[model samples]
Target chain A: MTRKIPQIICALFGMTLFLLYFSQHPTARNLNLTILNDYFQIIFAFTLLVGVVSFVKVNLKAFERGEDRSYHLVSVIGVFIMPLLAIIWGIKGDSPFMWVFENIQVPMQATVFALLAFFVASASFRGFRARSVQATILLAAALIMLLSRSTIGDMIADQIPQIADWIRNYPSMAARRAILIGIGLGSLTTSLRVMVGIERTWLGGDK
Target chain B: MDAGTVIAGILTLAILTFLYRDNPVYKLAESLLIGVSIGYFLVINWSNTIMDLMFVPLFTQGKLMLIIPLILGLLMFGRFNRKTTVLSRIPIAVLIGSGAGVAIPAMLDARTLQQMSATVTPILAPDGLPNISELVVMAGVITTLIYFYFSREHRGWWGKSATMGTYFLMIFFGTTFAYTVMSRMSTFIGRMEFLLSDFLKLTQ
Candidate 1:
């Protein structure tokens, strides 16, 4: 009963929304957009609670098991205190919550981001070895783009930017668009299947 | 130094610490990110859903019909309690139904149909150059699609065609990786700048 009911409901709702989107009526469009937006926001709210609970559960479990309990303590304390402070006192410029976020959160995200640079350098070194015609073209294109995007590119040759622009605007865009089109088709078919109740993995699993 | 500036500087330093190695500083930063993102999501939803959607329309415009969906939405919380969790199915059912009703036509109109239309373009124009770019795009699309056809063996022209398509696919992946790297490097740089300028006030 649980399985069948949700599947049917999803099929009905997906179809309605799909039709509403294509329909000419402003009222249908407005109703569909508004309701979906509402649902999205609700989902977001509940998901936040889920995240908090998950964090606490992991850290507390670690502490209980005597596994790297100190770091766990720091994480749990940080999570609870930072949000509590923000909620109670508000996140003004001088507030501790805002300070922690700007200092701690932003930097951490940036650090993860920075690791990608070294990864790229290593990958490029390995990737650009011109063992094939395709590899040679790729290496050439990357070199051109790198040079053209910088001031030194023009110092060496005036047409570097033009070449880069042509490569990006023509070949790269063409390939990307083709891939996007294929993806779009696949996504559409899946969406249709779900709407019709033929696909039901999203509501947990197929009934 | 100003408090805001100091905080920014510290964050910048913390970010830079990642380049050296994974440490307690990096972990602290990572945990905080998870915590704050979740918090931001919560606050955003509260304001957008509870205040804007449910309360405003119903109270001011007298759209009392909205109450049914509101009740259904609230019932989703029954998942927290074992005894009443089965009742959560009612709301889930409604969501599934509504979701399906919304997706089908849009998928057909926007994705499949439009994509097909885009592909049906002129391969050769009056000016003799044969629209080389369009020819390549068409060729790539055809070959790649053919490569995915699993019912038969990719032999002779089909095999050669799929092989050529794989080259294009590799190039695409490489370029994507390169761009991602650049983006990450810039992020790292931004963090470093914050630390130098804001935290230590070294550049004054």
Candidate 2:
């Protein structure tokens, strides 16, 4: 019952969802919306809760061993503090929760993201070698793109922007489309496999 | 300056310290960021998904149908106990199965069919001089697809086409990297402006 039940449920739900896409009936559409709006989200939220529980358990367990106690404490405190603030002041615009989100959360997030620029620049400097025909083509394309973004492209040639735009629209775009096609086919195959129970790995690996 | 701006500026500068090297200050900020973001998301999920969707509907409106999801969601906690670990697989299976089912048709329609349709443009434009850009894109698409085909050993004419495909792939990778760098640089520049103009008042 334990193993078979999950597979049964998976196949049933998968088939039902796939059929709903084809059915033009009103009930079909409503059922689809309900599943999307309630079922998936509720289950996902529970998964998140499970994750939070695991996080706390692991962190507290580690704290007992005196490993990175301070960092763990900060993380746990952060977990509690937001909810506590929400309960106290509510999630309103003038609330301390919003204040923390705007000032502390957002600024920190932006700074961290922005820091990637330097890292990427440093990485390209080391990796963007022109040792072969392929490497040279890649380098030239990258240089064109980067230079077009700045004044250097215009100074070197007036049509740099147009050239970059053409490359972006044609060669770059065609490759992306091919990748998408591959993903589409792959997803379809994987979905069919799961539907037919061939892909039982999700059931904790056919144990 | 407001207290918010001052506090934000300090945190931003503290994080920027990492560019110099890892330091105690950066570590503290990093820890706080990690913790706070998790807490924030937890609160959001609790409020939006649990309380509003499940609890409110089931309790206030008395929608007994919601019990199914509630039960499924509760199953996720089964993973915590070794004896009940297999039970957690129930909800996971439902989630993945339904998601994959929905994605099958969606992926075919949007990713495969639409893209293929777009690529199948007329080779000759209205000017009738054999539109160069369209031909290049068509060629690029065909060669790139050939490059990705792994079932057949690339040899003879196939090898040549696959090699040509690599050039297009390189162009794609290069532009992608360039755009990513530019986006990051834009964000960095924005942060600097915030620090100078809004917080420090160093720039007018």
Candidate 3:
């Protein structure tokens, strides 16, 4: 009964929302707006709380198992400190929370993302070898793109940028459209399957 | 220089050190990054969404209907209890159902229909001559779609078209990869500028 009820609710709500999008009635639109703007917003907010709890639980378990306990402790402390700071001092532009975020979080996040530069360079050097006809085409296209974006490319030739733009606008865009259509069709099928209760993976365990 | 700039510089270098080798310092920085991000997100959401939108409006505006979602949100935490884990599925179902419902028509309209219409442009330009680029785009779109059609055996003309499709896909992927590399390099440059120009005052 517990399992069946949620599945039914899922289908009901899914169908309602799907139908609501096409409805012209003011009441239907109002109801949809309320549910989306209010209910979904509130529910999503609590989902973050769920995320934090799950994160802390994993870290706690890791600490208990003594697997990189110090790092886990630091993670937990960092998590707790931000909220504590916000609660105590408020998160205004001049507050301690903003200061920590600007100094600690921004730099860390930017540096982490910046590390991708090294990884991409190393990975491309290994992977971008022109081993086959298709690979050669890819390598040529990539080289053109990279060159077009660089300062040296402009000095080399004006035509390089034109060719690069043509490749991006025509072939790249066409392939992107094809992929988008495929994704749209796939998602539509999956959504319908979920609405019909055929896709019960979300029910999470042996059904 | 203030304490914030100094601390930011140290953390930036700590993260950069990972490029050479994975050490405890890198691990610590990674952990702190994850921790701080979660903390930041949690506090921001609590203030912006929960307190500002939900709690404040509920009390000040006297919107009693807000309690329904509030209860549903609270019920999500019931997953922690083994006996009440089933109850958590209610909110999960609502979230997933609504998300899928909203995404379905939007994806169809924006991704499929709009993209298909875009590909339907005239092959001939206003000068009454066939535009080579438009012809190539049309051919590329058709061939790429054919490549994804896996039910039929790839032989004869079908095989040729699919082969062409693969070439287009390769170009697309390669362009994406190159663009990503460029953006990543820009980010790296930004960090270097911060360290050199802002922190050390070595370059402008």
Candidate 4:
């Protein structure tokens, strides 16, 4: 009974929202918008709490086991400190919370992403060898695109930029659209499966 | 000079130290980053979303309907308790159902129908000449779709078209990779600029 009730609730809500999209009736539209704006928004906020609990639980367990205890301690301290600062001092532009965010979080995130530059350079040098016809085409396209971004491209030939632009606008766009359509169709199928109870992985039990 | 700039410079250098090898400094910075980001998001959601939208509306405005969602939200925490784990499924189900429901029509309209319509264009230009670029786009789209059609075995013209589709796909992937590299380089440049200009005051 416990499992069945949740499955039934899922189908009801899913079908309602799906149908709501096609309905033009004022009452249905209002109900749909209300559920989305009010209910879903609140639910999603609470879901973040679940995520925080899980994160803290995992890190606490690691700390208890004395595995990387110092790092874990730093993490726990930062987590508690930021929220306390924000709540007490308010997250204004000059507040300590914003200060930590701007100085610590922003730089760390940017540096982590910056590390990808070295990794990408190394990977491309190893991977972009012209071993086959497909690889040759990829290598040529990559070289053209990279050169077109530099001042030397125009000095070599003005047509290099034009050719790069044509490749992006025509072939790359077509391939991207095809992938998008595939994803859209796949999502539609999966959503339908869930609504009809064919997909029950979300139930998360032996059943 | 300023504490914030010095702290940022130190953290950035610590993270960059990973390029040499992993060390405790990098690990500490990474952990702090994760923890602080989560806390930042949690506080933002609590104040902006929960306090403003949910709690205030329910109490101040006397909206009884919100109680239902509030109950569902609280019920989500039941996952923490073994006996009440099944109760948590109720909220999870609603979340998944509503999410999927909302995404379906929206994805269809934006990703499928709009994209398909955009692909349809005149093969001839306004000057009554053959538009080569338009023709290329049309061919690319059709061949790419054919390449992905797995129900039928590739043979004859279908095989040739699929091969052409693959060449286009390779070009697309190559362009994507090049652009990604450019973006990463720009990010690296930003950090270098911060260190040189902001931290050291070496450049104006």
TM-score of 3: 0.97
Judged by TM-score, which candidate is best?
3
Model 4 residue A50 lDDT score: 90
lDDT of 4 by residue, B1-204 (tens): 899999999999999999999999999999999999898998899989898888998899998888988999999999888888888888888988887887789888898898889889998999999988878877887888889889888889998998888887888899999999999999999999999999989998
Best by lDDT: 3
In candidate 3 the C-alpha lDDT for residue B114 amounts to 93
Q: Give me the runs in candidate 4 sitting further than 4 Å from their true place.
A: none
Worst 10 residues of 4 chain A by lDDT: A198-207
Q: Write the per-residue lDDT of candidate 4 for residues A38-136, one digit (tens) a residue.
A: 889899999998999888988999999999998998888878888899978999999999999999999999999999999999999888999988899
- Which pairs, if any, clash in model 2? none
Give me the displacement of residue A40 in model 4, in angstroms. 1.8
Give the candidates in order of DockQ, highest first. Answer: 3, 2, 4, 1
TM-score of each: 0.85, 0.96, 0.97, 0.96
Residue range with the least summed lDDT across 10 consecutive positions in model 3 chain B: B45-54
Q: List runs of model 2 lying over 4 Å from the truth.
A: none
Evaluating just chain A, the predictions reach TM-scores of: 0.91, 0.95, 0.95, 0.95
Clashing pairs in 4: none
User: Which candidate would rank higher by DockQ, 1 or 4?
Assistant: 4
Give me the overall lDDT of model 3. 0.91
On DockQ, the stronger of 1 and 3 is 3
